[model samples]
Structures are given as structure tokens and as C-alpha cells.
Target: MTTTSVRARFLGDGRIDFERATLGPVANGQVRVRVDVCALCGSDKRLLRSGSPVVPGHEIAGTVVDVGADVTVPVGTRGIVYIPVFCGTCRRCAAGRTNQCLHLRELIGWQRDGGFAEHVDVPARCLLPVPDDVPLDTAVLGLDTVGTAAHALRLWQRTQPDGVDRALVIGAGPLGLGVVAVAGAFGVGEVDAFDPHEGRLATAVDLGARAAGDLAAENQYDLVVEVSGAAAARETAQRVVAPGGAVIALGESDEPYTMPATPRWRRTDCYTVRSFYFPTSEVEANWDLLRDHGAALRDRLTVPVTLAELPDAFARFVAGDYFKPCIVSEDAP
Candidate 1:
């Protein structure tokens, strides 16, 4: 069966074009989803600037409407699309580290056609089933916002077995706000956040983080999460972290991550934990986190718009007029 759907295409130099795409039958080992909500991410800016070869909306939540041969996931099952297409047979995958799969090559939005359309075909294994009680919009945050934040904190716990006393988050964007929202639940104490944009920083404060007084202060926070891809933010994270503390690098950048050979940098002894998206093993736990904090986050971060309004939504997103703009399907419940 073939389906025609309206999807967004990114043309280079900050342009978006909407076109009707003819999607062929679901390939074997795949499932076709009717996208209910696809949230804009900061990472999508890179694709918007450079233009993507495939459709580009990664933080996705939808309902499975069609299944390929041999797939057990029933139609009408709600799920969030896991971006990393991991090979299930790999040792890392066998250990439930799907994000760290040894054979990971393509991310759904980056390398393959993603959820900027009404329907998207993805690997059956990449569908994370949503609980019946969770709303699709709230469940979508499990992909990048709350999911990644929780994963980073979980990994940081390994470095500091006791607990995080004071946590600092640089960049109060969607993900940074996510960390702030879940920090207390993760046992982090006295969370503080910084962002150059006052509006975003205020949002972080609304999410339970204190406004950072000074970015220049050193050796203050026990855990510093760097969520902005800016080089300066990375430097700030390295500087503010205490000697025995850990810096969780969750940001992505095209610019090289540099460790300056300053005397302070040379003497400090700290663990730098870099984390990717959450592993499938953590999905159940993440759902709990979402259930506790997801609604507030959705209210603060997401501004829902129709599929036809996607280009305008992205325009506002680029202008910082919207925090996280979501393309919502008309039929979404």
C-alpha cells in the first residue's frame, strides 16, 4: 500500500518547503506510524542550516497504524520513535545499551526520513510503546528532553556514589530545563541554571532552578551539566565544577570541544561524563519520571502548531519566539 502525506523539506540556508511525499509499503521489520506530535529540538537547527537529505523531525510520538510482515506491534499502539537504529544482536545492545550499540550508523532524523510528515516508517524495534495513561504530547518528551537528562544524571551517579550536593546547568533551553525539572527527583540538591537569554533562564527558574548569579564563579557546583553546544558554555562548565565533581557533557556542537591548557584546567581532577540518548533499559524508569514531571514541562516548553503551520513554527523557533514548537496532527487524541 502507498500513502501520500505532507512533509517538511529543509532547503539549505534556513528555508523550509512543504511537499507531498508518496510513502511506499512498510518494509519488512518496520512499522508505519501516524505522527501525532513531533517536537522541535535545538539539534534540528544544524539540519535547518545545512539542509537534510531526509525529513528532519526527531523528537517524535505517534501511533502505529501499519506493520510490516512478522511485526508483532499491533496497529493503534502509541509509541515514541527511538532515533538510534541499533542492531539488537550487538554486545552493547545485548546489554540493553541501545544508544551505545556497536553497529549504530543512522539516526532516524539525521540519516533517514524522520517524523516531519503525517506518517513515518521506522524499524519495529525503535518503537517504544507508551502507556495508555500517558498523553502523546507528554510522552514525546521521553525522547530527548526528560529522557536524555535523566540518563545523564544516572551516569553521573556512578562517578559520585554519595549524591549530588549542588548541580549547575548551563543553557536553560529545553534540555537544560528538563534537567532542572528532574534534578530533585534524581536526588540532586540546590540546582542552579544559566542561559544568556533572560526568557529561557526565567523558564528554568520556573522549573525549579535558581538563577545562576555568576558564570565566572569557580569550584561551586558538584555536578555541572553542559547542554548548550557553545564552546564558552563548555569552558564555563569545566571551570565551575569542584575538584571531585563531575561534568556531564550533554551538548552537541560542530565546533571542536577544546580543553584549554590553563593552569586551573591542568590541576583540576574531575570526571567528564559524556552521554548520548537514553538506553532502552531506562525507558520504564523514564516513564515514571515523565509521569511525575512531564505535564509541567509540556506546558512550559511546548507550543503546539498544525502540520501546515510547521514552517511558521520553525521561523518562530529560530527567532526564539517559541521554546519548543510541536507539529500536532489534526486527528491526534
Candidate 2:
């Protein structure tokens, strides 16, 4: 059965165009999702400027409306789209590290058509079931915001098995605020956050982070999470982390990640841990985190908009007027 879907196309240089397209008879191994909500992310800003060949919204929460051959997911099942199109048979996937799948190539919103539309066709395996208690807007955060942040912290725990005494988050954007919200749950003590935007920093404080007073003070924090891909923020993370501490880098930037060859940089001994999106293995645990903190985070970070208002939402998002703008469908339950 074909469905007519309204989707957004990102034309280069901050332009958005909509198209009404004929969607499928459901491709094999894929299921069609009627997008309930799709949250805008900071990474989308780069795509906004440069343009994307595919639909660009990855933080998706929706209902499975149709299924392909061999699929057993019932229609009307609620889920958040998992971006990574992993080869489930790969060695990494077998080990539950699906994010690092050996044959991974496409991410739903990056290489494939995604949920900036009335409906999106995604690999059946990419549909992560959302709990009945969680709203679609909040469930969307379980993808990028909470998922990435939790993965970064879990990786840090591998190096610092004793748990963090004090942690610092650089950049209080959605993901940074996410790190703040879950840090205490991960056994981190005294979470502090630094961001140039007063409003965002205040939101971070409301999420349980103390305002970081000095970004220049060296050797203070046990763990420093760099969620803003700004070069200066990267530098600050390295400077402030105590020796033997870990710096979890979750930020994405077009600019090359570099380390300046200064004396302090040369001498400081610390772990620079970089993590990708969360593995499917962690989804259950993440649900628990979301149940505890998701609604509050969503209330502070999201401004709801209709799909047609996506262009304006992006403008406000770029202007720092919206922390996380979500395109909510009128039919959304």
C-alpha cells in the first residue's frame, strides 16, 4: 500500500523545502513509521548550512504503521528510530556493540531518508520500542540526547572503574544538559557545567549541574565531558581535567580535532575517550534513565512546532532561541 508523505528537504544555505511524495509498498526488512515527533539536534545545524541529500532529522519517535515481508513488528507499535543501519550479523553486532558494527555505513537521517516527514521507512531492526509511559517528545531524547550522553559516561567508567568524584561538562546544549541530568545517576559527584549562553547554562543548573565558574582553572575535575564541538571548549576540557582523569568527547564538528603542542598539553596525562551513539545493548538501561529524568529535560529543552514550522524552528534553534525544537505531528498521541 502506498502512502502520501510530506517531507522536508534541506536546500543549501539555510533553506528548507517541502515535498509531497509517494511512499512505498514497504521494502523488504523495513517498516514504515508515522512520525509522531522529531527533535532538532545541534549537529543538524551543520547539515542546515551545507545541505543534506537525505532527510535530516534523526531523533525520531513514532508508530509503526506498516511492515515489510518477514517483519513481525505489529502495526501501531510505538518506537524511536535507531539511526545506525547496522549489519546485524557482524562481529561487533553479535557482541551487542551495534553502534560499532563492522559493516555499518548508513545512519537513518544521514545516508538514508529519515523522519523529517509525515512517514519514514526504516529498517525494521532500527525500530526501538518506546515505553507506554513515555511521550513521543520525551522518547525522542532517548535517541541522541540521552543515548549519546549515557554512552560517553559508560565508556569513561571503563577507564575510571572507581566512579567519578567530580565532573565538568563543557557546553550546555541538549547533549550537555543530558550529561548533567544523568551524571548523578552514574555515581558522579558534583557535576558542573560551562556554556557561554546564560540561558542554556541556567537550564543546565536546573538539571542539577552547578555553574562552572572558571573554565581556565587547571587540574580540577575528575571527568570532563566536551559536548560542544567548539575548539575552545576542547581546549578547556583538556586544561581543566585532573591528571589521570578522562575527557569524554561527544561533540561533532566539521573542523578537525586537534591538540595544541603546548607544554601543559604535552605533560598532562589523561584519557581522551571518544564514543559514538549508544549500542542497542544499552537501550533497556537508558529507558530507566529516561523514566527518571526525561520529562523534565524535554520541558526545559523543547519548543513544539508543526512540521510546516520546521524552518522557523531551525532559525530559532540557530539563533539560540530554542534549546531543542521538536516538530510534532497534529495526529501525534
Candidate 3:
């Protein structure tokens, strides 16, 4: 049977155009998802600006429309596709960390065409079952963002220094807010989040953090969580981190940021840990961290938009104003 699919394709040199394509039946080892909702991640816009011609959206959640022979998934079953594909025989996959595998591009939305399309194919091993009640739009958070946050939290707990009661999260974007919420859930006595944008600061507070005054210089906390991708925020994190404290730099800013010249503060007696790929990778690690906080947070943080509004929302994101804008599939499965 033949079917039509809609897609938001990046045609290179900072261009994203929606187009129609035809899809054929899945073959052995492949599963097809009737796309539901997709999220515009920070990485997508960054790549566009950097001149990479690639499918943009990575956070994807949807329903299974077709399963190749020998595949275990049932038709019409909703799920989130784990983006990291692996050849189990590889040393990295053999170690059970698929994301680190060398042959990991077969997954949707990264090496191949991603979820921006109405239908996406994936190797069977990368599929993960989404909870029946979880909204497709929100379920994508589990596939990556939440899982990444959870991973960062676990890493921090393992590397934390003594006498750290507070955590300073330096970015107020969705991932920054995610770090804040997870930090709070991790039992940190206080969580102070920072963002230059007032609108995102409000969103951060809603996600369970006390908003810091927009990157203004302050010497305030013991633990610094830098999820802000700003180049300047790195200095802010280094300045605010207390003596013998830990600075967890989780932000993904494009610009190069230098630590404050003061080696006494940034290096001496302090721990600097670069954290990434949290709750987004290890389910067992992220599940317990977010068992109580799921799609509810996404609902509070996301602004639902249809495909038609994508450019406008992306424009807002470019101007540093969007807060987890998720696309609603016109014909969501």
C-alpha cells in the first residue's frame, strides 16, 4: 500500500521547507510510526544557524503504524523512538550504551530523516514503549530532554562536594528549567535558576525553581548547574560557585566562554563537571528521578503550535523567547 507523509525538511544553508513524500511498507527489522507530536529542540536551531543541512526535530513521540515481519510491536501502538541506533556487536553497544556506538545513525532524526516527517522508520531495537496515557506531544520529553536531565542529576550527585546546600542553574530555557526541576526533586535544599529573558524566568519558577536575577553577577551558591548555552554564562557559573563547590556545566551555548581569570575560584578547591545526556539515556536512572513529575511539567512548560506556526515560533526561539514549543500533528496518530 502507498501512503503520503508531510515533512519539515532542512534543505541546507538555513532553510526548512515542508513537503510531501511517499512511504512504502516496512521491511524486516524496521518499524514505522504514524507521527503524533514533535518538538523544536535547541539543537535544531543551532544546526540551522551553523549551516548543517539536516532534518531538525529530535524529540519525537507517536503511534506505531506498521511493523515489519518479526517485529514485536503491534499496529496502532503509541511509543517513543529511542534515537540512538546501535549494532549490538560493537564495543559500545556491547557495553549497553547505544548512544556511544559507532554505527548509531540508523535511528530517526539524527543521521537519517527524523520526526519532523509525518512518518519515520526506525530499526526495531531503538523503539521504547511509551505509557498509554502519556500524550504524544509530551512523551518526546521522555525520549530525550527528561532523560538527559535525569542523567545530569545522577552525575552531579556522584560528584558533589561537601557543604553544598544550593544549586544555581544558569539557563532558563526548557533544558535549564528541566535541570532545575530535577535538581529540586534530587533533594537539594534550594534551587536558584537564572535566565536573561524574563518570560523564561517565569517558566523556570513554574517548573519548581527560584529564578535568579538575569545573569547579574552574584556570589550566591554552592552548586552551579549551567544549562544556559550562553557563552557568557560560563563565567557567571564560575563566579557564583562557592569554594570547594561543584559547577555542573550542562548548557549547550555555541560561543566559546572563558572562565573568570581567577584560577583561585574556578579551579582551586572547586569541582568542575561537564554534564550531558541525562534522563535522556538511561531509563532506570531517569525514571526514579521523574516518577512523580512527568508530562504535567511539559504541559505547564510547552506552548502547543501547529505546523503552520513553526516558522514564527522558531523566530521567537531565535530571539531567545520560546519555552519548549511543541508541534501538534495535524493528523496525529
Candidate 4:
């Protein structure tokens, strides 16, 4: 039998070229989803800078159109694709840290063909069914933006038994705003957000965090979450972290920097500093977080664009025109 054909896009230097590709039979334990929407992520900027040679959209939501043997989710189920592809038998996977699997293969958006097309195949184990009430567009951000923030917050909460006194999130981008949105949900008493961009800072304030122009607080915050991936932000996190406070660094820096900068440390300071990744097991809870916040939050936090406008949308993203750009199918509501 002839294979079905689907439209796919390949990335170039800030440009996208379209192609028609054949969709093969679904492999065992896999599902083919007709993508409804794919939210462009903060990390997608890395792809943009590198000329994003591969199909790249990790924050994906769609309807399952086909499924192979052993897959229980029926066809036509609305769902979101979990981006991290892990070896399920690894020790980390056993401990529920699939994101840290010993043999990490491809991340769906970066290393594999992702949801920048009419259809994409995903491992059934990586698929999470979207609840009926959750919009596919909002569901897209649940996979990465909110998921990662919730993961970071969960880790940060482990260090604060008495609850956080003041939580500061650096960068005021999607993830940063996410940190502000959910910090109080995680027992943070007061939340503050810092960003250089006034527009983003205002968005942060809208998300229930007090906005700050700079990270000049001297040892005032009990928790500081750094999401900017900028050298200066990391340096600022070090400066503002109170003694016994913790810093969760989620962003990646382009240049190498000396860890344990002597200037930012004091002899008696005891703090925990660590990097965080998405939690594959937390999909349901992450979806719940978005659902609980509802459309008022989702609408202010995200905007939808058609896939054809993705390339230009990305350009506008870099120019600071949109906060969260979600690419949706023409038929998506």
C-alpha cells in the first residue's frame, strides 16, 4: 500500500522551506498525531540563532490520528507530546527522572522531527492526553513552559520546609512568568520578578509577582529562580540569594563561566544551587496547574499564530513583540 503524505517544514537561516513527506506505518508503541498547535519556546531561540536546521517545536498538542499495537489511547484523543525521549529502562527512569535518563537520546523538537508540520509521530509513552477542558493552545505551553517551572518550583520547595519568605524569579520571560504564576501555588509567601524588559516586567506583575527593574536586593530573597540564561543574571542570582537560600538555574549560558564566584560568596553563607529539567511524570499535575489558572491567565500569557506565520512569528519574538508565540493549525479554535 502507498504511504500517506503530509506537509512538513524544514528550518533554514531564519526561514522555513516546506516539503511533502510520506508518513510511514505507525511503529509498535507509537502514535501519529495531527498536530493542533505547537508553542514556540524560549529555547527555540537557540534554534533560531543556529538557523534551526531541524523541525523544532517541543510544546506540541494534537489529536491522535493513529496508534500502533499496545497503545491504549484510542484514535482521536486530544493530547500533548512530551518532548524528552528517554530510555525507559534506565536507572533514572526507574527513579521517575526520565529527563535525566542514562541514555538520553533525542529531544523531540531539537533532535527529532517535531510538530512543525501537519503530523508527527511520537512514542506512546511520551504522550499525555489533554483533559477535555484544556484548550490545545494552552496545552502546548503545559508541556514545557509551565512544566519546567513547576519542576523547578517543586525542587525549590524541597529546600523550604517552613515555606518561602520571598521568591524572586529572574528573566520575566515565559518561564520566568511561569515561576511567578505558580510560586504562590507552591507555598511561596511573596513573589517578585526581575527583568530588563519593561513589557515583560509588567507581564510578570500581572502574573502576581512584584516587578523589579534589577536584581539589586542584598541577600533579601529566600529563593531566586534564574531563567534568563544570561551571564549577568546568574551573577545577580548569586548576589541576591540570602544565606540558606536556594537558587534554581534553568537557563543555559552560551559562554563558560567560573562557578562559585568568590565575590558573590560569604564565609557563612550556605545555599543550594542546581539546574533543573522537565519532569516526565508531572504531566497531569502540570496540566492541572494551567487548568486551575483558566483562560484569563492563558489568554494574557499566550497568543496563537498559524504555522505559515511561524518564521515571521519567530522574528517578532526575537524583536520582543510577543511573549509566548503558539503556532496553531488553521482549524484549531
Candidate 5:
């Protein structure tokens, strides 16, 4: 039998065009997913607009269309693809830390094709079951944004046992919105979010946060988080960390940007920069956490779009539209 699949490809310099591709027989520990709904992360926006031959979507949810010989996923199983692929024999993989494996750069969109397509081929270990109650959009995001936030939250809580007395999130991107929503769900006190964009600042307030102009001015908070590390945000966070407080750095970019460090106060704890990756043994940890807050996150993920609308959606991505725009297929649930 022969099969054809449709997917999107970026032809370097900011052009994303529709294309057709084929899938050969599935390999060991691999499965094919028919994408239902995929959320475009900030990185996808950057990469797509950078003009590269890359598949754009990383946060993807779909049904299992086929399974490789050694794969256990049954056809029709609904799930999201965990994009961090690793070679099992490597030292990092052997220790069950696939995300940090040296070969991670070679997997998913970079070396192998990714989920901007109708069908995605992934390792069985990378497919996570989508909860029946959670919608496809939420499922995809749970795998990344929410997962990272929960991981950071756990570490943040460990640093200050009294529970969140005050919190600061610095960014207006989707991840920042997600951090705001999670902070509310987890009962953070004095939720102060800083973003220059009036629209996103208002959205933060709507999501149960108190919008503020400068985090450093509101520096009384015990916990500070850097989500995007913009020049302004970095400058603000240096002043925002409370004396002896813990700061979680969650942003993705590391340009040659020099950040202004705020004068240190003696009663202070230096910031902690966390760039977390997926944990393997904690199998489906993200799904479990999402189960706890899926409904509300589903509400946060209410921004909707269509497959044919991808070009427009991506254009808006360049223009910064919506708090978090989610691309959906006709039958997405």
C-alpha cells in the first residue's frame, strides 16, 4: 500500500509553503501521528520567520496512525508528540535523561521532520497519551509550556518553603501567559506580571494577575521569574529579586546581549537560571499536571485558527496577535 501526506515547509527567509511528503515503513520505537491540533510556540515563530527549510510546529497533538514494529502505540490512540528525541545508548539516554543527550539537536524538526505536517514520525517514547477530558490544543501545550512551568514551580517552591509570598513573571509571550495562569492555579500571592505590551499586560490581569510597569519597583516579591529575557526585562529582574530571594530564568534565547545587573543587596540570594528539559522516568508527568489544571488551561488556550489559515496565522505571529494563537484542524477536540 502507498500513502501520501501533506505538511508545511519553510523555504528560508520567512516563507512557509505547503508541501507533500511520504512515510516509509515505521522503524523500531517509532510511530506515525496524524496531527489534529498544534500550538505554535515562540521558537516556531522565530525559526519560521528566519527563513529556513524547517517544519514549524513543535507543540503537536494527534492520533496514532501507525506504529513501528517495536512500538506499542495502537492505531487510533490520541496523543501529543514529545519532540526531544535521544539515542538510547548514549550516556545521557542511558541515564534516562534524553533531553540532555548530545544528539538531541539531530532529532525532530532540525534533522528529522517534525509536526507541521498531517503526519509525524516519532519514537514511541516521545508520544504522550492525551487525557480524554483535555482538548487537543491543551494536550499539545501541556507537553512543553506547562511542563516547564510546573518543573520551575517545583524548584521555586523548594527554595522558599513558606509558599509563594510574591511572584514576578517577565514576558508577554505565550509562555509568560502560561506562567501567569499556572501561578493563579497554584495560589501564588501577589501575582505581579511585567510586560510593556498594553494588550498582553491586560491579558495578564484578566488571567488573575496584577499588571505592573516595572518588576524592580515592585521588588518586594520573594520570587522572580525571567521568561523571555528582553533587555528591559533582564534589567528589571536584576532589581526585582527580593533580598535572599530565588529567581527562575525560563527564557530560551541567549544572544550576545549584555544585561544590566542591579546593585546587590546583602540580604540576597543570587538568581537561579533554569533551562529544564523533559524527564523520562517521570513518564507523562506533564499530562498528570495538566490533569490538575487542564480545564482552566483549556480556557487559556481558547484562541482558535484553521489549517488553511496557517499563512495568516503565521503572519499574525510575526505581528504578535492574540495572547496565544492555537492552530486547529477541522475535527480537533
Candidate 6:
């Protein structure tokens, strides 16, 4: 087939440009999806700030419209596309850790074209089928937001076999929100969410977690998930985790985190801290979670807006006007 021309949006330097671009033909073992919905992530904000030329979306859910040779799923299958483009022969891919694949050629939103367009072409291996009952936006959230949280939770589980007593999530953003929601859904003993925004805390509370600015009890929480990359938040997470408790840091920050000098509070031997990133299997499980709690998750999503409104909407989103905003295709359900 000839090169496909599509209208797509490029975001960089806090600005968005929409124009007609010619997309290359789908390669072998690739598929083209008609994007139904794509959501903004914290990483998107960072990339926008950098003014780098990227398609700028990793959380994508859409319907397959075309496929290259040897594709498994037929055209018209609806699903969420995995972000990492990895070499299947790599050891990491063999172990189901595609995110860590040494031969990663591209990350859908970061290094390659993503879903902020009429159509996105991706490897057929990247497709994870979403049940028809699940909403497209919810499916997208399952891949990035909930999946990241799930990965962290799995790390915590590996550390503390008994499970969390009291859990603290430090951040009120989309990832923080996902942590709180998943904790609630999984029936954690007590989940407390901390954030600067009252609105976000309110939403956290609505999702079955107690909202607070900080943990009152020192070294009380068995699990502390640091979703906010702020140095202060990272320090707080370490301080509040009980001895031998698990601290999963999912946030990314450019600055280095320094340990306190004090002996009492600076006990490095007291806890376990692990960094996490999303894995493919976790995202598949997240889809199941989304299926069960789709309505609740849907409630947290900002009202969908058309692609034309994304620039202003993105500006507003950065200003804290929206928590998680979805870009809706005109034909999206």
C-alpha cells in the first residue's frame, strides 16, 4: 500500500501543532489502529516542557483498522496498545519484561509515533486485547496508570509477604490516584493518600482511601508508594515506612535524593526501597481490574474533549484544572 496521509498532532515545548503528515506503510508484523482515545500522563507533561518533537501519548486504546503480514489479531479488533517496542528475541522480552528489553528500538510515545493522531501504527506484538465490555478510555488507563500501580504493588508484595497494614501513597496525580484506587479495590487495610491539592485528596477519598497531607504516625505504614517524584515526598516516604516495610518509588525525578544525616530517622537498614516500571503482564491484569471497577475509574477521568481542544486542554491540565484528561475521537464510544 502507498503511504497513508493522516491528520495528527505533534506536541513540544508546551505547544501543539496539527497538520497532515504522511505515515509509512505498516511493516511486517505491524498493525495500524484508528485511535479511539488517548490520555495524558505525567511523562507527557515533562516531554512537553522539553519541547522535544514526539507524538506524545503512551496510554492508547483504539480499534485495529489494518494489519501487516503474519499478524494474529484480525482487523477490527479493539484493544490497548503496549508502549514499549522491544525485540522479541531479547532475554527481557522472553521473561515478559518488555519494558527492560535491551534491544528496545522505540517507546511508542517517546521515540515513535503514538496515538495523538487519526491512526497509529505499532507492532502487532504490542496489542493486548481489551474485552468489549471495557470502555476505551478505561482500557488506556489500564495500560499506564493502573498498570504502573500494579507493578509497584507487586514489588511491595514480594517484600512483605504478610501484606500491607497501612499504605501511604504520596502524590495526588493520576498515578497516585491509581495507587489509591487499586489499594481500595484489593482491600488494603487502610490507604492514605497525600497531595497538595485538596481537590485531588477529595477524589482520593472518594476512591476509598483517606486523604491527608502527611502521615501522622512515624514508621507506621507497612507499604509506602512514592508516586510523586519530588525530593521531599521521597524523603517522607522513607521516613514513614515501618522497619522492614516496603517503599516502592514509581516517580521519576531529575534531581538526586539525599539521605538525612540524623541517626534515628536515617536508618537505611530499616526499610526496603525499590523502583518500578510497567510490565506487559501487569497491564493485562490491570485491564481486568478496569473491567470490574470501570465505572469508578471512569468517574475519575475528566470529560472527553475532541482533538482540536487538546492544546488549551493540555494547558489547563498542567494548571491543575483537570486530573486525567482523555482525547476523544469523534467516533469513539
Instruction: List TM-scores for all candidates, in order.
Output: 0.98, 0.98, 0.87, 0.92, 0.88, 0.92
Query: What value does the lDDT take at residue 72 in candidate 3?
Result: 86
Tell me the tens digit of each residue's lDDT in model 4 across 1-333: 114534435455565666777887888899998888887777777776665556777888998889888899898899888877888998899988888888987889788878888788899988888888888877777765788888888877778767776888889888887778777778888888888899888888887888754566668787888888898888888788888888888767777644564755855264555645676777768877888764545687677888778778888887999988877787565
Count of backbone collisions in candidate 4: 0
Candidate 3 on 234-324: residue-level lDDT in tens? Answer: 8788777777677887777657756666645535467777753522247655545445666656776777788767777788767776677
What are the lDDT figures for the candidates, one per model?
A: 0.92, 0.92, 0.71, 0.78, 0.71, 0.77
After the best TM-score superposition of candidate 3, give how far the Cα of residue 197 lies from its true spot, in angstroms. 0.8
Stretch of 10 with least lDDT, candidate 1: 157-166
- Clashing residue pairs in candidate 6, if any? 13-51
**CA shift at 272, candidate 6, in angstroms?**
4.1
Tens digit of per-residue lDDT, candidate 1, span 1-333:
888888889997888898998988999999999999999998898888999999999999999989999899999999999999999999999999999999999999899999999999999999999999899999999989999999999998888877877899999999999999998877798999999999999999988889888778789888999999899999999999999899999899999888879999889999999998999999999999999999999999999999888878888999999999999999899
**Each model's Cα RMSD:** 0.9, 0.9, 2.9, 2.1, 2.7, 2.1
Any idea how many clashes model 3 has? 11
RMSD of 1: 0.9
- TM-score-better candidate, 4 vs 5: 4
* Candidate 5 or 1, higher TM-score: 1
Better of 3 and 6 by TM-score: 6
Candidate 2 minimal-lDDT segment of 10 residues: 208-217
Q: Write the per-residue lDDT of candidate 5 for residues 247-281, one digit (tens) a residue.
A: 77777765644545434544355556575746565
For residues 1-333, write the lDDT of model 2, one tens digit per residue: 999999999998999999999986999989999999999988888889999999989999999999999999999999999999999998899999999999999999889988889999999999999888888889999988999999988988898888877899999999999999999878798898899999999999988889988676789888999999999999888889898998898888989989879899889888999999999999999999999999999999999999999999999999999999998999998
Q: Model 6: residues >4 Å from true position, as ranges?
A: 2-11, 184-187, 213-217, 270-276
Model 5: how large is the Cα RMSD against the reference?
2.7
